[model samples]
Target chain A: MSGIRLVGVLGGMGPAATVDFYGKLVEETAATCDQGHVPVVIWGDPRVPDRSLSLLGGGEDPTPYLRRGVEALKQAGCEVLAVPCNTAHAFVPRLAEEAGLELVSIIEVTAEALAADGVRAAGVLATSGTLHAGLYANALRRYGVAAIEPDEPGQRRVMAAIGAVKSGGVRPAHRRALEEVARSLADRGAERIVTACTELVLAMDGSHVPVPVLDPARLLARRVAGMALGAALTG
Target chain B: MSGIRLVGVLGGMGPAATVDFYGKLVEETAATCDQGHVPVVIWGDPRVPDRSLSLLGGGEDPTPYLRRGVEALKQAGCEVLAVPCNTAHAFVPRLAEEAGLELVSIIEVTAEALAADGVRAAGVLATSGTLHAGLYANALRRYGVAAIEPDEPGQRRVMAAIGAVKSGGVRPAHRRALEEVARSLADRGAERIVTACTELVLAMDGSHVPVPVLDPARLLARRVAGMALGAALTG
Candidate 1:
């Protein structure tokens, strides 16, 4: 309890995305040796019911599983928590209240980053569940930043690309579909595009997009690292 | 209590190596969807006293810290455990007996793999602590395989390359040193070279070696994944 704060990750909303986030967390930390890195405990339960399907009323409730993960982390002596999945954050408010630990919000951190950079309008690329729940939109709206969502056709393509990433691997077609939707969003006055979905973050390369890309997972990783290292808290 | 076994990782011997091991775990799993992947809990405490330093009698004992990690993972409900660090295997015998959980050994898996492939003599590249502890040498000997270690000067280069991977990043000098040692070992009647140290596995590209490279971390990852997924356990 006296050393660096132990960080807990509630992961495996999809196993690959969680690994990606952990890699980013390692990369973001300023460490000169093995001892300089933060301590972390991860409860990566891939068996948690699909967050999107659950939110869309097509799958079992994932709240129980999510709660179980949080409880395990707490029992393991985690001082703070991070959930890497965007759709999973739809349940964060209640989870945070019951978790009794500081839960870093990926959505809040992404919105704050946009607001701090003077972004007035930003395009969001995420799963239908995140969009349906308005997780990013609601967070960004509070900061007076407009969240531009993909149109119905564009969103369908986004979903297809995300699915391709999860099922096997992303194909050229999936990348092209994501690129088209990103351009469409940029055409609709999106100053910057946010890859809110972890799956899209894995599938879409930022260089292919029309505008600058904001990766919420990377942002959240940095925030968590800073907190664990006892650095001044910044958005 | 009766679902898929939760795999626990006793990691953070160095953060990057642990991340590399977890990434390999994800890649080795035959998962078509999120739920298809195995559940995992990782106690990644970078503050665990340096295994190499402690083994050299130059740093604090790491046993207490290692035991603490084991207890935490147990409390978190992990069914099986894996330690990614090669040097840490020196403590595994005692830890396993007390852990009340199945601990997958990187050293044993690597040896078994070599034996299965009909490799008679294998070059082992690892930290000084691992060489000093004879973790790989003893494990290979049990399978009637000869363990070929680097000469004095070559051992120094292996250590330097490992340090380079831990401190900042691998440089050309580090890669060249590793390549030279690998060639020297191959010239000494070695059939295959084992990247026993996790850091060396990260720094050395497999294709650069003259002989086929055996990565123990990858072997352990597949074993842990199989155990969790209820697949038949194989060497």
Candidate 2:
């Protein structure tokens, strides 16, 4: 039997984010030819209920649909699973237990990456659900690092940028708004910032941000490549 | 029952191209929200034998692997299917008949799009496998449009560009090579050009091409969106 590991993506929390995650996965792999990369089976069911709304208390439970996506990927013979959405990760432990599959956590990994890079505190840019759940803060705390988020006005801007990206309407204004948020966080003494929202990552270019930015989607892709290919992750 | 058609992607002919196709599918959909877009299930098995090499007569027959990919998508309940790789279409007729799935033809649809846009003749930038099989020539023949190609040296440059893209090494040299080939074809009286190879499309930017360049990947994505939405094709 071939020893290639198959990575399954439980994606489509937002279709564009899922697509971006897949692109990063390809870019991170150390392959010069098609065969050099790991094999992946993607069950991108955009019908999966909204995770952010569910976590924020006004939407249907996404677990059932998330379960179906996991089952589909498992049936397709995936050895390891990865989810690109940070907010959706609130369901990962339960989903992994139920599916009896190994899941790489984006939050845990991103937080560890921060500590590894000697970052003391970083600004968190994500959905209300992720912030409310303290996903990044809780994870970073494990590594003795602190996670900070935008204040009310800045968060409103971040949310607007995320919304614009999700609707496929990322105008120049959206980019400017996200940049302003990053600059505000930097002025407030944030040495680095984490783009925890996939939509925000799509809309915000790292070169334009005032501070160094860590993208969870890119980190997740790196972790996935490491797990699937048993190699060290590289930029 | 909801009338949303699930688009199945018979992909992983090379994983990057498949991801690009999904991104375009999301972009072309008339969705203002996550639920507004069509549902899609992608089975990206990079294990599928090389189609261009196979058609070029020194690679494994890709039919069995193609059948497996189609069957997987069908079992996952994809109502319509799309194959993003142009050379892979050489197997579509037989695969569709065997799987009883309506497979959208990137080649035929592209040829028709050229005619609809009033392109009298277009340069075909593709792999040796596609040129040798006359895939675009045969399809364009039905539309009464002529197909042009690069000379031997220019064809060599085109091949290098495609290889550079597949290896994720899209150097400036590769871009220049492709641009030179496009200009060469235009000088030969080709009114437009088709980036028939997905890798070629990834390497090229339309602004750099002197003549109008049609991207089959984008055209294929539009067709997939139309089929999934039950909408008539629009120019």
Candidate 3:
């Protein structure tokens, strides 16, 4: 089958990223106006511990919240699950196991998208946890997509945007500052960018970069849709 | 009441706008990531007879499509209706009448936003149909906001980009060409701007202009959410 009917989003790593992923799936899908695009079921549980906080021991383990979110989407008739949180991917396997739905891995799809685009050199713009854990770097290297990240200062800009959004201070200016970091990645010859964090898409509010920006959320959505519909999906 | 939620969108017409609205709703709402954003139903029916096509003739009545779209959202459990198309607003009263939910009027909010900003003279960058329809101009004028659109050539550039997106193209150069109109409007002494057409927003892509850009789609979404959730919305 060519068309997958529905995709589920297991979100709330943060509110902003959840929205970014849902929007991208609709934007990228090839669908007629009257014909339905794949219907999406999203679970945006912002109450979950910040994915990083749980990992860092600053908050309670998010496994319970994650399971709840995954179950909510499954109950909504979602055939496949896509987590919009870069940091939460660490917990995805367990969450999927608990929920018993095929959850597409954001990090894995991101790495795959980069390789497909011939991104020999790419940037991983995510949180301190994703970076410190070497999650994307590990996945990308397997696909020959050389991964890059900002310097400490560049990382700060990203962190600032993430902090701003979480604190509800999501001003356009804060987003602009992050775009500057993205510009640097491109300037440094990074072939593609993985918006590894949910908040990072805010930086592109009215912009798209010259090279392909590998949106992990969207890729995961398509894959989830494929799995749910039992549609043939080319890796 | 303070924490009552509202839908927020970053729309740009061209099917993408409606999709963006639905996607953002699912992304940012109080739900699970997999559960999708709140219960948003989108009528991403971009093939509605373009206002330009209709105004210039040889097109079908957008009224039928608009009716169908608004009803679709309502049928899908939308508590509030929002038409992401700027020009199609000419038929909004009809669409609203057909909808099961309250329709958020973008023109009124844009004017209100201008008035609150203390803007008496505001620049406008929209498709030719919207500019010619004078919906924003009339609405703003009531609030004592003198709405000024780009010069004739500027209007042409804006329309070209609108055409591009409606035709399913997302070219950056085409968007830049449209941005020049906003810049020109800013240079012409307009204190604020209304991105009059939903398509005009696709061209904006979060780039900074000299002043505020009143994104009607986002505003409409906010209003829709507010009304849906019974929240008191300001601006």
Candidate 4:
């Protein structure tokens, strides 16, 4: 049904995260020339009701907005869709079914990646919405990878770091707070740490972490590129 | 028509340049929160026939592909448009007329910026396609800003630097070559240097240019952001 599948990005869960995902997609593609890069149709509707706020019962439903974005991308010729925000994956299955487009789940993809890498247990750093909805927890469990989350206070720190990044305060304090949480998770026997939140990926610079950090956004970019290019995926 | 205008990005003249433009748009927006950022519908079709080759009499016309992108962005509700590629602007006035979208001209924006900044003469660094079509030259002259282009050998180096960037070969040597060209232009009494080519923007780090570098893309981004936010335009 395709020559090259167009990658639809359901973005603007946060504007910066969407831009970061697009940049990573360009960087991960094995293109010798510009034409070799994947074709992307980004529906960056910043109006999408905030996912975390909804999951926390503090905001409106994001389903309708997400559905509209999916429809727009499909109309624009995207054969496969990916939402860069991890919290947004809660609506993926339903939206993917409704849109009839192959949706790439950041949670499922990351869990599969962890299982494939023989990780028995992994630490997750994400928004309270993601943890509350069991987005990563359920996926990891289904993939036979135990999900370890930071303690309540640690989770608060993660949320604060995420908030700082979204507010354009990607300072060293934000990174340090995340690193401290990652270290605490590693102390509790997490073999690897998953930066499940896109904002957290922006905050933490992948340095000085106690364990190896797994960035699902980067993985999703590689997967999207491989699928678009019809190449064996490896990252 | 009553609300803030949606920004349509006619992109993928080269994938990296599109990303750079989007990033700049996000950065330049006067946003204190995620919702404050502009809504962008990007039609990043990498398969658009090469603009430079088409302009230089070596490739198919890019008009059809550009029209499709503009149409898609319009259908997705982009009220205003901007194309990041300077070479792509050769088709802008016509496409903007046909598509009935208010397209922001990077060349015009830069020339206006130069004139506003009280600069009488400026040097241009861009692809042969842009130079040959006099995109910046004509726009600068219209604004009473004298446009100075690289001499034959210097032009060759600039073209090579652009090719290096397009092929994803952004080596230090490429940056050095472009810097040498900029320095030579400065030596010839050019007061301000206009980085008319997006690729050249990628190569030169903007740290050590002898004179001020007027980045048209950055100017375009700021303009697009200001327009979308309904703010007074200033660079």
Candidate 5:
């Protein structure tokens, strides 16, 4: 039997999202037996300073903690790396460079998926850090797709929903807030909605959205699974 | 805020079970925010040689692979360890000793839980390897709780259901088979049913069973979360 690549997940920007990504990865892989699935090593350090808080210049810089996670994954012999949090991807390039590992960019993959689907415009739902950093915007721009973002009030709703998910289970209020923001984005001519925040993916279901939903975390999981199983070429 | 301990999960005996365990851990934590949850590092090497096959002397030894996982977790700075698979507990004693980390035994925790509940006899649903190893029987015996196992035919059904879950998603057939066995065990005077196998925990829901179900994985997750969050003492 051919060997599968060991994929490392640098996670716990919030613990639930990391678990969500891992679960999706297992579901996406074409494995008949236990050994047929991809081997994974995850460093889920929830203590890593909040990515959004840091990006907004209000909290401690998460670089050192993120670097520690990358080093641990590299030491454990992971050939490829995936960071589940969209905001955390802002630091992924530097971490991948320092660790000399093939890091899968969730933003790039989502953009590529949108372009492949002939989507001209997509609404992004993510943390303030991810929106401020333009991680998804820049990637989507490169694919010739227009990235629509939430208005200030909508963004607040998005952040509130995200906070609700992170703090505990998603209540009906959180889901309703996200659905409203998604509907507003759709009314503004968004062809599809991208759940850029991992926590948002947990809160908002695709069926409840006004338009088709694109989950970056699930896309990342599928890409990582494909790479590990050798079903798709590792880029 | 006080620091939470990093718990290492040596998993992927079947990838889905590990995901289930981690998800439960996240849910069980008294976290209102991401950092309030336990930090975790998982070495999910699905490639580990089959624990059941090894115990039955029909396949390669899983010791070296398990040792590799233990060493990887130790190097990652995990202060405590948990293995999600019930069959894997057969090697937990040696691995804990070799790694010098506190390894939480799912079997022992389950027994403790049963004893605390004043359960006199409990039905166990697990893999043949775990049955052969007498992990639950011995642990439960220590707590003065009688462990009732499936008869030979029922055991075969249990193994088949586990294999079904590992191969892919659990089907209605698999759940039906397990429910039947659980019913038979209940009819035989089992006070409670212990879903000793992690995979069985995934396939069979507690409400569907004839008696109250105790999931060792959930218990393990709760125990580890408590220990990590300083809610309970680490044994």
Candidate 6:
């Protein structure tokens, strides 16, 4: 494992997010040779107890199962663990503590990256669970950056796209609605549209959008790669 | 971990192959709910040093890296590790030994499924390295089943499609050439077309061939599900 930090990803909130993170890791890493590819240990168990169910008191507490997943990764030789699912981040602190691995914080990195790029206020087009959790709001506050989200109707559309993507169906109507949500956010002063969900990143097919997209999964992938390459992890 | 067996997949020979395996896993697993979904860990480091370069003697040996990958999975809490790459199976024994996890054999599963289906003979379509290494030949010997393959020209066509897929260019020509190889193999007493490469499985699109088409990855996925579900692992 010399010069290689195995990234343990506790994923499968939906398959698309895991695929997006893996793609970004492959694309961002500067590989002189094939050997430079970052080593990622991905447990894309979408079977993970539903985040909303447990959070909303409609389902079993996800702690036992989530902890089991984290333990699975720690045993698998992952030095750092990442959860690509925006909703699943709610349980991050406990999961990290129980698993005993340094987690690559998704919310903090997104806020910092946007602020660094001089985007003081960026649009966060994410699912209702993510919006309600205030994960980004808490993180962005420190940096004096505002986290923008969709209006109620727009939120429903974003949730619809997310549901379609989670179910492994990418319908045309879904794409149009999602793009409308992005445009609406931009119209409401969003400097950039954050494709917070992994599926959104994959669903984005170079549609002509005025606002730049900040895919949080892709950003986290960069941090994970930097750790893998011994690049000081400064960012 | 008690009832489920985590399947470890060392993939990323090309991005498409890994995607194919993932889709097959989703399709084959018997999941009433998400948790019933098989617990899988995939290490899709596409930059793992090229196999041909190491095998044909240019770069360092891939065997060491392959071993490391298996170890990564073993540490990832995988009960059984499987290599989705057909050619990589050529180095399985050594890697499996180093990883100390039960390595599910792809060639064995493909052959067993064919023999069980009463396939006295079949067409084997795979990568150049898989063919050159006799991975299929040895596996088919057990059932006394004769398998036809492409002639030199047909081999060239098959190799071309495999190369095109690995490079992320999905062209009509590549699909056309693969179809031609399937036809050629059928002309030579092939009762079934064995999709040895996962990419070939998608290219074939589950459209029944003049001869029946067998998907080895799908079959392998079924076997993993069986092993995990405590159902009999048949072919």
TM-score of chain B of 6: 0.91
DockQ of each: 0.84, 0.70, 0.07, 0.76, 0.91, 0.35
Residue pair clashes in candidate 1: none
Total backbone collisions, model 3: 26
lDDT by residue for model 5 (B1-235), tens: 4456789999999899999999999989878888778889999999999999999889999999999999999999998999999999998779988889998999989999999999999999989999998999999999999999999999999999899889886789889989999999999989999999999888886677778999999999999998887843333
Pitting candidate 2 against candidate 3, the one with the higher DockQ is: 2
The per-prediction i-RMS, to one decimal, reads: 1.0, 1.2, 7.1, 1.1, 0.6, 3.5
Question: How does candidate 1 fare on TM-score?
Answer: 0.97
State fnat for each of the candidate structures. 0.91, 0.69, 0.04, 0.69, 0.93, 0.41
Higher-TM-score candidate among 1 and 6? 1
Residue pairs clashing in model 4 are: none
CAPRI band of model 4?
medium
**CAPRI quality level assigned to candidate 6 from its DockQ score:** acceptable
Candidate 4 residues B1-235, lDDT tens each?
2467888898887889988898899889866567778888998888888888899999999999898999898888787999989999998778788878998889888988999998988999988999999898888889998889999999999988887777788888888888888988888888999989887788887667789988888999999888887742232
Top model by lDDT, which number? 5
Maximum-DockQ candidate: 5
Query: lDDT-based ranking, best first?
Result: 5, 1, 4, 2, 6, 3
Q: Is candidate 5 or candidate 6 better by TM-score?
A: 5
| TM-score to native of every candidate shown | 0.97, 0.93, 0.56, 0.96, 0.97, 0.78
**Docking outcome class, model 3:** incorrect
TM-score for candidate 6, residues paired by index: 0.78
Per residue, candidate 5 scores C-alpha lDDT tens digits across A90-207 of 8879989999989999998999999999999999999999999989889999999999999999999999999988998678988888998998999998999999999999899778
- CA lDDT of A94 in candidate 2? 84
Error of 4 at B157 (Å): 1.3
Q: Give the per-residue lDDT of model 3 (tens digit) for B52-106.
A: 5565455676767566555544443445556666776767756666554565778
